[model samples]
Target chain A: MRGITIGQYYQADSPLHLLDPRVKLLCTLAYIIILFFADNPYAYGLATIFAFAMVMISTVPVRMILRGMRAVLFLALITVLFNLFLTPGDVLVEFWIFTITRQGAQTAAMMALRLFLLVLASSVMTLTTTPNKLTDALERGMRPLKIFRVPVHEIAMMMSIALRFIPILSEETEKIMNAQMARGAAFDEGNVLKRAKSLIPLLVPLFVSSFRRAGDLALAMEARCYHGGKGRTRLHPLRYATRDVIAYLVFAAFLAGMIVVIRLF
Target chain B: MKLILDHVTHIYDPHTPHARTALRDVSLQIGEGSFIGLIGHTGSGKSTLIQHLNGLLKPTEGSVYADGKDIADAEYNRRALRGRVGLVFQYPEHQLFEADVFKDVCFGPKNLGLTQKETELRAYEALQQVGLEPEVYDQSPFDLSGGQKRRVAIAGVLAMRPEVLILDEPTAGLDPGGSREILSLIASLQKERGMTVILVSHSMEDVAAYADRIIVMNGGGVTMDGTPAEVFAQADALKEIGLSVPAATEVCRRLYAAGIPVRPDVTTAEEACEEICGCFLR
Candidate 1:
């Protein structure tokens, strides 16, 4: 089903999948920071190589990462085009009113590479780590925010459930669409307004059913004595291993290199 | 005319990382006006196979001829094909979204670009067919009970006037009495319309009681296809695929196994008892 495919965290015994999710989350943030600080062409190329190496090491199929990238290709291309056309810089080649500048090209390329690397790194974390584990790390890491009474645990729990249901909801959406189609509702054809209006049959039922499922799930959880964040113990306890230490050290090294490359080069 | 699938194969999202083949080289001809029950294990390609009937899914490497037209043709009118083959999905209540029963049931006819008068008329007729009263037409569908909601969903599909009605797990999550009510409504509707009714279910007893033909699917393949009696007679084969014959048929098989003079072909409990009594000399 389409629902199951979207959130399929590859279950593997690889080091990337086995590292503490908390460590992975921190490293992903640091990785994005390093990506942003990389300024020159050589630095961006190096970052790309590092990302590809990590993608391989994660043990996720290259085909899978490419599929995920395909979903965001449109946005990446748009960002690149916008930056290329809009960003003001010194002109290298003039064409009518527009100018193709070396600085603009460099900026646009860096921006494109930055966005691509950011998505790829984040996807690497998501693909290797289950949502449940991600939420567990988030809840535990955000415990410091309890001083402000932000309901961080509850927010993380809600996020975990939402992540869990993305596929479920997609499948439900497909069914609703099919039911509407059987009723002669044409989704693929028609003008924008007509197509928008055609979705009423699908959307109404989907919203109602989502609420119904949420209500039922809430009731079931209540019946099972699921009071929030009181004494909840996880079945799998997260532990920092030697790989986590090596990964964090590598991230620190990458961050230093990015700063040196941007400032000096 | 019969709907024929010749060596049909369907792969969901081909070339994607999660690409999966839901059906494989499945070939079958479902005769017109025949009540065929499609039984399958979960993820056995039953849903995938039925979705092809209406062109909701185009086969990756095969053809489905509906009313003698190849649905896989690039120029095929998919919307019109959908009108001819109504697919009532599992948990039909999940598709109920209109403000009232009348508007909901009329949704289908209206989509077909029928006149307002015709849509209203067809909606009323569909409600009547499903045993829903005209008085409840103005009431919000959300206010109805689970069984009523399901029937309303079914009526919405029937309002399209589909010649072939395919129901997927219609009795799921219903109590025994509610299941009977829904099944009887389906049977009566099929009889009145003389429509080709394809019931996809996991319950052996349901298929045994109503379907004239049974098709069993397991692990993305059609494992068995025959009349209900014939299919249920292959108890061992069904069991091998994580399915079973009807309880009555199993009882008959056990009785025959124990040297009792009862036919193994008896599928329903009533038929089993009559056969057992017939074997005993008065």
Candidate 2:
């Protein structure tokens, strides 16, 4: 159960970790948007090169990034298979009800590549940026939302808290599952409905404990004079360094290059 | 049932970057119907060892034999073995999920494939064994106090009618009164039912008071296995491993160091009181 790595920040000292989280977050968003716009092979190749360079400069292991790919592998495969079989073009191979077309194969491969790159690029942002810093940056970036009374700080706090509790809740679930299993509760043995029913024994305790933990956290926060984000100060205020500006310029250049490549191709 | 661990070794997340050896090449034998106390500090593998008793975890190396049969064998029915050897994990109440206490207690026997009537009867007997009243059995388990909820959780395991009962820190997070009550209840259950009881605890006093045999673990290996008196006699050795003898045993050790003719093996408060009284009378 411990193999889960999604949304987990990998701690490493590199330019990526040093960049301002807000800049990184915006750059990631731009990268994902550019991925959809890059349709041709040359544009896709340029985008892939840019992603690979970012990953190398970040000093995060390629294997770690690939591990994050496991989460989206099924979705990538489904998109590829659907496009391969369903899209119409010059038929390269024909079967009873399925046709392997030239355009279909190219589209499937390109779609799979787009999906993979999107996941990888977003994972880079999450891997290098600490949740606390990410939330701080998010709260700062959304300050304009205060004009609409959106409670930006509260939303950031909720997101950060949810991220922090993911691992804790997973560990609790494993413990409860093992405890129930010791009582001869076969979670994997039953049919679909039976499996769903077995999960009740696991979920009820998890909800109860999570609520208890939430209560304790609230009390602790209040003890420290936490009364929402009003007039709250940060220990490490989000600041843009020299490297962060360089990173933003590089990301903007990469996006412009991808757009130019797509237009020319 | 007689349980034997033959050079058991357990490694968590094996061949991974986060791999850890939780249990070393440790071998031990637990006879049938013996009340054994397994004591260790937080990471000393006491919890890992007990999980192997009922096949909740298979040893990474070596074999665990129950009733002279290797449970790790492919043909062994682990489900039936789990029912025969119930394991109550630490803070077991966290596993309770039924609408009411009675249904929660009935879960174990129902899983064991007992009929509805048999399941209810076993649940009633188990709840009664844990000193829970019948009226509270109809209430939501979440409505009960912490101690009561824990008892209901224990009754859930007890309903399986395990031949060997293993409780990991059963009295953890309980008040003094509650701890004492639960300890006494376990003692009575062991005596009355003649079931093999293995208690994993951190409190030296509780183990000293109730356990006939004490197994001390340190650094994923068994360091000491003997009667309470013999184990507590090595107070300095246990202290070196971040464990302490019972308060009464510590007192006896102090008296012995002060040139008084007191037995250092005295473990319980009652025994220390009698020894000190005898010394004063002399």
Candidate 3:
């Protein structure tokens, strides 16, 4: 349960940690978008260098980044397998009815690399930016959408509350599970049907308690006169620093390199 | 019910920047029918230590033995061990879920693979043991009052008929009357069933009133282990670790320092009252 890192911010005194969350958010978005456009080795190489440099600058442990990747590794493997066995291209190897194609191998490699880089690039942002900062950035970033009656502030408030609840809910889950387990509720050793049935004791109370918590939180927020984002002010408002500007320049250079590689490829 | 921890060391999030040594080479033994109060400051490893007693957590270093068998062994069944050492976490009422109190109580015995007949019988016995009125057993657990919900939660664990029961602040979030009632119920259960009860609490008076033995934890190690009177006698040391001596013991200590004849080891109000009356009365 502890292994699931929802609030991914790894506290550290480093450049990436100091970088403005707005910059980190935009950079991650840009990085992920550029990752999809990178079709060749040169483009991927430039992306890799950018990703690793951000990772190194973030100072979040390498193992943690890789740990976050483990969940997506299976999806990547499935993509590889699907491309390997099914992609129509020049045949590299032929068996009775199966054919391994050259294009399929290349596509699979690219897809796997893309998946790896996608998670790596995004984790660098999440691992450095606190949930508050990220949510704050999200709210501010989408402020322009308020013009279209998007209710950006309300959406962000709910999101921040949810992100805040994840760790709390997870800790509560562990407590309930342990409490139930102590009473001989075998959550691990059971068939699918039996396992789902075993969750009844754990889930019921969890839902009731979480709803109570939510109601309490609402009361607290209302007690403080929390109305939506009309005139509400944050304790720490987002602002771009020189370090953030410098980080943007570095990203710009990477993007230019990628554009060149895209043109060449 | 001979539960022993042999130099157990538990480190949470080990090898990470957030790595914390919650238990550091601490060892203790719990004999049958012993009501041991495990007291500690908030971060002093009391919770971590109790989790080891039931195999909810394996020690990063060292061993926990229940009935002379290593609970951490690959072949050892943790489910059965958990059944034997029932742990009631703080605010246990939060774990109650069944539509009715009786059904909720039966959850534990049912988990033990008991037949419906046996499970229902154990549930009835457990509810009675916790002093819940039979009429309330038919009501939904959620509909019950806070104290009733707490009793139902404890009854859930008791339905399993554990040899050793560890309650982490069973009376937390209760009124004074509710707290005393719950503690006395646990005290009586320990006396009647002869099951080892480890009460993890922050209250000095609660321990002094009920526990025969007190084990004090500080900074992830067992700093003091003795009878309540013996442990509470060191007022300075207990205060230094952010734990208090019982209120009665503290008053007696003040009296002793004031050149009075009151003994320094008076742990309970009754003892201090008797001593004071005997000293002053003709």
Q: List fnat, each candidate.
A: 0.88, 0.80, 0.93
Best by lDDT: 2
User: Which regions in candidate 1 have their CA more than 4 angstroms from the true location?
Assistant: A1-13, A34-49, A59-91, A94-113, A260-265, B257-260, B279-281
For all the predictions, what are the DockQ values? 0.71, 0.78, 0.78
For residues B70-184, write the lDDT of model 1, one tens digit per residue. Answer: 9888898877777778888887666778888999899888888889999898888889999987778899999988788889989998988989999989999889999999998
Question: Candidate 1 docking: what grade?
Answer: medium
Name the lDDT of candidate 3. 0.90
Worst 10 residues of 2 chain A by lDDT: A1-10
For candidate 2, give the lDDT: 0.91
| lDDT agreement with native, every candidate | 0.86, 0.91, 0.90
Model 2 misplaced regions, further than 4 Å? A81-106
The DockQ of predicted model 3 stands at 0.78
TM-score (second chain) of model 1: 0.97
Task: Tell me each candidate's RMSD, in Å, in order.
Answer: 3.1, 2.1, 2.3
Q: By TM-score, who's the top model here?
A: 2
- In candidate 1, what are the lDDT values of residues A96-162, reduced to their tens digit? 8777677777787888788888889988998999989989899889999999998987898899899
lDDT of 2 by residue, B257-282 (tens): 99999898999999999999999999
Scoring only chain A, what TM-score does candidate 3 earn? Answer: 0.94
Error of 1 at A116 (Å): 4.2
